[model samples]
Target: MHIELSRNSSVKLYLQIAKTLADRIQSGLLPQGTKLPSVRHLSSLLSVSPVTVSKAYAELESIHLVVCTQGKGCYVAEPSVSLHREEALDLSWQMSLIDYLPRAQLWRNFNHSRQVPYSFHIAAVQPELLPTREIINDTRRLSSEDPDAMAVYGTFEGDVELREVCAVHLSERGIRTEAEHLLVTSGAQQGIDLVARTFVGPGDVVYMEAPTYTGAIDVFTSRGAKVVMIPMDEQGMRMDILTRLRDTHPPKLIYTIPTFHNPTGITLTTVRRMQLLDLAQSYHCLIVEDDPFSDLYYKTKPPLPIKAHDLSGHVIYIKSFSKTVAPGCRIACVVATGSVLDRLVAAKSTTDLGSPLLTQKALLPFIRHRLDNHLVSLRDQMQDRLTTALHTLQRFAPAEVTWQAPEGGLNIWIKLPPAVDIAELGRLADREGISFLPGGVCYAGGMESNHIRISFSYTAKDTLEAGLRKLCRLLGELLDRSVIMERRPIL
Candidate 1:
């Protein structure tokens, strides 16, 4: 039998040797008739004295686990084994306590993937715009040059070379950061989870805009934190209300999607951005900025990121390239310093060790090559798509419905009449072969129900107007009725 032992274990060497062999016997790995080695042979194999091997054999015999013949070797005995399991358990009750992201009917019908044949529910680059051939070439090239890219485990913080490159890229965007302060994450989703798990606790307050990313709401709430909703204005988070909240209860963290805010597509103004930084520092609250759309801007240049003005590391900035860069790459980075950075890295370690090194290395060269030329084409095409979608909405939408043309982002948030039934609207829209994100899921308290988020990034150019017309028709029908009925009973 092949055996390995730990000298540092508290158990005696003979007992350790006996347990290992006994386990193999009970497991049926060592068959009933199988012969163990001679005492001297086993002693030499285990690098122990013959007396230890004899004692181990004697222990197995005393337990009736093995048969020792006078001249021959010891053999495994037939084992009567029993494994206990709870076939009918209250697992649901236990899971209800910690389960986040349960599959609901809304998402079951419309997911991030292309499960639905016709969809506007997800935001991603069109297939034509994605650098498929280039990505393949880069992956093949990396595999040939550095086999370790796939063979070895990446550093806990992720690839050093990739981090250096990311540092330079962030510097160009007005965020003066170094490689040491950044931890590469699977995507912005994990970045949010890491910050939430590392810093937030049960009953701690986490302030976020009323209508923000649904994933953030789910993460914080599932962890038992009290997620307080801050109101949002045209510019961004309402600073006046934020200041009042600060005076009463200082939040553990303030989560924001500052530039091209999710669902709403509203970018925070430069003045608001500065004010947010000051408030965060004064309230002793850390800002978790989830930024995935700043690079996807259209006409006007978006204001500097809230992290750009952070002089004292009050902000943990998360930027994802999964939507803008190749979707399959699943790449993003987190920028923070001090204890926040240290804890986030530790949290990330428990999440997946680190994002796959092969993905990081494979995309590194492609990113370097695409910075100028490929990005320009990408931006131009997305801008055209957004323009087409906006025109379509304007042409068909009724006078009462309104939407803000975002500075740069993939989504256009449509505001329905407050009385309109959003759930019924979603069901009808699904029947029409179009899917979009209902705004109710975006709220922490899940009470808001007057908005829907549609993406212009994934649908084809030719199908854009037709899909939008269908949505407008449905909305027009829903709004025409004096009282649109809600799917659930009014409380």
Candidate 2:
């Protein structure tokens, strides 16, 4: 039996063989109760270890795809029952979404990818890092003291007290805003959607850094806006290209993640931050400054958000606590001075009435009291993981592959050799039981690129060490194979 195996995958050899054999059984290529090859015979035929073949057979047995007799060899099993019927099901939506559906599908695929076990693609904080005890305390205290806050519908803009807390928080970060200007959003993604819906429309040009957040891209494109990609460097979004695009496109909004940028983990220089604000003002374009990872900085502290220097209220600043404080809190505050704030509030009304009152109320005390202490410890733990990941890469990665060391932020951006295919690498990684955010998913157009984002924030330190080594080994093997293939004579 010739069983094809993925040499570059992170998945173990036995599981791959098991899945392949199972597929053959399902397809009726292998009849029910058909005698299968002995472990020694299969191993010899496939050029794999007998132990691997035995494990594969064992896996098939566990899945009930095969049954082993006490004295005889393994045999294919009868088809088992399933909960649902297998049929072609497709939704015929009212709207013509031919152009838009691909984006939705890509977003859905990326989201589904996160469910894989031991996923390194997840950028959110680990569950162990969350302040569960503190939240429980806050919930109990709030339920006793402010039952009305929990039961009754809260204000549309958000609780005045929480808004006040957010305002003070924003002020500390150099974003000068009052409770009146602050609007509580469900999350940073919703905030981006609100801004996109309120301000953007069909054919309205939106400028963003090439490898920006996927949520921002979805918001812009789903609204039928033209998203123009701006290039980036170590300092952050390229101001030269931005100015030229501003002149060419006359963009309605410039969406940016200026601090601890996603995927790349680059921070905008203070000078560039100031310059970006100036460009936003001069071009009369709104800057959606999504600042989530700023607080997670492990190296040099980043400069203030563009909203901090918003002399004309052109910048909409959103600071999300979900990534750092709590994953399900879904609480982020938006700072917009006048019309932006009012429109966002109106948009909030349209998009699910408002964020749950209980979530807001429960988080208020935690934010007020426990956040600073939690962050101190959280930052230290993340720093250790970051150090471990880097050390692992140094020890295992191919000399040809280079990763730019990020000062802060959850991800390390790896620049692959130009000839390498990211999709192939991604499949290999997934097969090997590791998942990662391919750099293309970070861009506006979902164009495959030579960069890969490895996050150290989501997994355990031990998991990170092993996962990084596996990833590096996969890259090394792939790079070597590509070199060999390049030199081999083609028929």
Clashes of each: 0, 4
- lDDT digits (tens) for residues 300-339 of candidate 2: 6778777877878889988899888876778998888877
Candidates' TM-scores? 0.77, 0.79
What would the TM-score be for candidate 1 when compared with the true structure?
0.77
lDDT of 1 at 35: 60
Model 1: CA > 4 A from native: 1-110, 483-491
Scored by CA lDDT, what does every candidate get?
0.80, 0.79
What's the C-alpha lDDT at position 220 in model 2?
83
Put down candidate 1 lDDT per residue, 29-96, tens digits, no spaces.
45465567789878987799999999999999998778888987786665233211222442323322
RMSD of each: 17.5, 13.8
